[model samples]
Target: MHGHQIRRAAQVDRTELWSDVKPGSLYGALHRMQVEGVIEAVRTEQEGNRPARTIYALTSAGAAELIDHRDEALRDTKLRHDPVDLALQNVIDLGEDALRAIIVARRKALAEQLDAWLALRELAAPHIRGLEWTTFRHTELRLRTELAWHDELLDQLPKLMANQPTSMTTS
Candidate 1:
């Protein structure tokens, strides 16, 4: 479930999954999950002459695992990275305006995600009951926090970029 959500949310292709999961690798993690009866992949035929794609679905075991790890997953910070950090790391190579443009674009993308997250939360409202509300609430809080963070970053970017030199010369 986590793997699927990560792939879908990041809009990552199979090749990019390696970077997303690193260490044990996405394939290795998926295989391990399957072996442990967490998830099962169903083979589905694709259009044209292409091979079938494996669509993963969470098993009962998988749902239980997700529930068990929900708190840990929410608390884990080591697996995450801020794109702003990546951009700043390469700021010497990418001009301030260029990096600012990237931030604006990322902000737009995150806004779209927040919209989707809100829609999902709305849909889950009546459907989620009792203890499930705790999980849903956590998910909603995380999404809202992320949206707020993005807004804050976008707000602060201009001030941070103001003092930075925008041009570089080749020797």
Candidate 2:
């Protein structure tokens, strides 16, 4: 597919699968893949006044690499690092107000995201099935877990803020 088509597919239905891909960097990624021989430019086509576009096709090596990547992602269970953990550890220094503000903001954002996913699930329930449905379910579960964790943090905020460090030392 052409770069624009690929980007459109990534965006369709708010799939939440391409969180790491920046739209502007896609063409660059395609270029890099072409250089690496993972994908090749099949042809260029232009019609009327539209600019020429290059269509790319994946090679056998690319198919193998893609499968490897998909398998690794599916099998890998280790949790990725979240900066919020580091911030929470040192949150005592920020005072209670800042911590509350940050947590509140995060909760709001998470709630908004959850709402969007829930809406999508509702809308797509009749048409989606199998692996696609499973992906949606997985994302919904993660978001719910995050929301619960944030609520727990809020419940413990008073205790956490009250027990601030009394001294600091470096060795």
Candidate 3:
């Protein structure tokens, strides 16, 4: 697909939900893959009033790489960078007021995410088939689980901070 087409598909699939797949990163990846001879330009075509763009197709190497990456993606239990965890490590410095502010903002973001996933699931359930539907359902379930966990965290935050030194008490 062309640049705009790729971005459109990513938006439709909500790729940013599970990743940091920005347009800049996506385009950069395409260029890097092309440089590595994994993918090559196929043909350039303009659809009616649209500008001509380079179309790309995977090379044999690209297909093989894709298969290998797909396997790792399915089987690997990878740890992702969670900014919240990093912040918690410095919870001592965050003072109660600031920490509460952070938690509130995070809770709001998580709620928004949960709602987005729920809406996506509703959209996908009607059109997606078989295994794809099952995968989408699994994703929806994960989102619900995380959302619930955030509620628990919010409930326990006050107690967690109680033991930690408060800025007012320190100075």
> Which candidate has the highest lDDT of all?
2
Identify the candidate with maximal TM-score. 2
Residue range 24-135, candidate 3, lDDT tens digits: 7887878888999999989999989978998988899999988987798889887788787776866777766787787778778877877886777787777777787777
TM-score of 2: 0.90
- For 1-171, candidate 1 gives per-residue lDDT tens digits of 344454564442223422355534666878877899988986544658865556678899889877877677667779577666665755866655777687678768767877786777687677656776665566667767776876786678778767656555544
Worst 10-residue lDDT window, candidate 3: 162-171
lDDT of 1 at 57: 81
Better model by lDDT: candidate 1 vs candidate 3: 3
lDDT of 1 at 62: 88
Q: Write the per-residue lDDT of candidate 2 for residues 38-81, one digit (tens) a residue.
A: 99999998879999999999999999998998798889989889
Off by over 4 Å in 1: 1-79, 165-171
Task: Quote the positional error of residue 117 for candidate 2 in Å.
Answer: 1.1
Weakest 10 consecutive residues of candidate 2 by summed lDDT: 12-21
Per-residue error for 90 in candidate 1, Å, reads 1.7
In candidate 3 the C-alpha lDDT for residue 155 amounts to 82
